[model samples]
Target: MKLTTCFSTVRTRMVSSQPKYELIQEVGRGSYGVVYEAVVKRTRARVAVKKIRCHSPENVELALREFWALSSIQSQHPNVIHLEECILQRDHLAQRMNHGSSSPLYLELVETSLKGEISFDPCCAYYLWFVTDFCDGGDMNAYLLSRKPSRKTNTSFMLQLGSALAFLHRNQIIHRDLKPDNILISQACTPAGSCEPTLKVADFGLSKVCSTSGLNPEEPASVNKCFLSTACGTDFYMAPEVWEGHYTAKADIFALGVIIWAMVERITFVDVETQKELLGSYVQQGSEIVPLGEALLENPKMELLIPARKKSMNSHMKQLIREMLSANPQERPDAFELELRLVRIACRELDWDT
Candidate 1:
């Protein structure tokens, strides 16, 4: 068959059995699957479809877990990426065919499309795909890199991020894999706009549902280990407890600290030399420290290379970041406390007249 004919036939066969969604383009790719931009034909709405590479049991379980978790917490908070529906692509259509009974899960996309932008639309016969409110501003990692940071810009982003994390914590969700790549900006806040971006936490692949009531101090370490000892998250963002075979909501706080540092310093923990130095400094100090910010302030090479300034982050922000980055997880503030502090700072900064 010709290329177009083959693609059409495949699309038809795939959509007939599965929920019909128009595949616009590939938006993201990870170890587990490829995420695509699709549209719901019926609603003319945009959605994100994560097609997992069905190879292992662990991958399958994680995919299903994410779906279940998102479904459970769909209405809990506005900042979370809502789970619209779960989809299963036919086993035959998948790259790896399933011989016995098996199924896949499709997640609802959460981004919106832009105006005056036209792409290939399926013929009327095909099923209408779903669309989310597109985030034209892209992921936070990309957003930070694109900016020429100053004290004001760095502080503003940090405060906004803290607010988002606080909201998540209020809902009792710990985003285990908290990093720049997973943070997305709403499409409504675009280039040359004065409006602040509606920051939503995307990719609940590694999230855990904690209790909003309070931490269960009596809960056994084994119980905690059962849920957290898997060593499942990104290496750079992993907290000390995670590395030592224990994890909790505080791990998320630690990650938030790493993220703030990355935004202000425009660096990641992936660099071998930098990671080694930072880890050494953190271990030696035996307490929370903002090594990246300090490094940026001290090194002339770094000062010329990155726009981050230590003076940019006000004392309140610095104190908050240090609390989150506390080496001892017990010393770190819970999401609730962090949110309260962030709100106070925001109110003061914006002069809300409250």
Candidate 2:
């Protein structure tokens, strides 16, 4: 349905409507929701607002998961997308609900997520509004592919992404879908055509929070130790274990490895669905180029060329990427160690900041 129908529906439902944000234009669209470039009425600050229609069970679950994952993070990281607020919208008969700890709407949503079904009336139209930081520089895929390959940009991105993943893991959040399309580039405060653009890891609809028991105050439970059975993610970015429906946070690292390696070598493939040339690694199987994870799952002993191309690449960086993409998850370094190793590699590179 068109977004105009959505606004009209809301207008008919509410008697005294006071919208907090003004929608400027439609930014993106997914299966469950539509994202709009909006501006806060009070502060005149730009924000991206995601309006999710909780019409189906799958849509509701995805919306709740995204909300839960984003809301669960108490501390903010520069490299991660920041959630400003969430507003639950119902019919005119019911009151609009602002997200809070004690909101019944939230409790209902949580129960729905756990039960995998909606408890309320199936005909009752409800919506979840997520207000977040607007990225003007667009997604990583677009930003990187539009520019010439540069060591400085690659090093900067590596450090930023490593730090972001470390922060998420420490917070017990695992971003199952980690790819260039999901990662946004924010050029806020930077001048036009500036070299430095802040990376913001976003789209946590498939993310999982790994917070179980068995943890000491001195040393908390590592995210890598938290095993999950959901085989959900882009085919190209999934780890070998993820293909088997059993994996941990290390899967995120493997996905990042694919992105890093592809970025360094400028390897690209056209997405059949979107017809967009996306940066990622793939294995040649006869005439078809299959995902690295699927290829590794079929043959665990297969070795990948770290550099993919006969170009200048740092030995340390190459080795680290290789380890990160190891078929065995145990051999891959955790997010914490990945950050440290990336820093060391960046420091060793003579033209890291060039």
Question: Distance from true position, residue 173, model 2, in Å?
Answer: 0.5
lDDT by residue (tens digit), candidate 2, 17-106:
445677899989988789999887678888898989887778878887788788889989999999986667665333333334556656
Which stretches of candidate 1 lie above 4 Å from their native place?
Answer: 1-19, 74-76, 92-134, 150-156, 189-195, 210-227, 265-312, 349-354
User: Candidate 1: minimum summed lDDT over ten consecutive residues — where?
Assistant: 107-116
Q: Each model's TM-score, in the order given?
A: 0.65, 0.90
Give a tens-digit lDDT track for model 1, residues 1-354: 001111121322243333345677787776777777767556757767666643444455455456545655535444556665443433333211211223222211110011212121222111111123446677876665666755555656666677767766555566788767777776554588766655667777677665333356565222122245655566656666776666677777777777775665555433354342221112212444434323322331332211134435455766676766665677778776777786676657542112
- Local accuracy by lDDT, each model: 0.53, 0.84
Q: What TM-score would candidate 2 get against the native?
A: 0.90
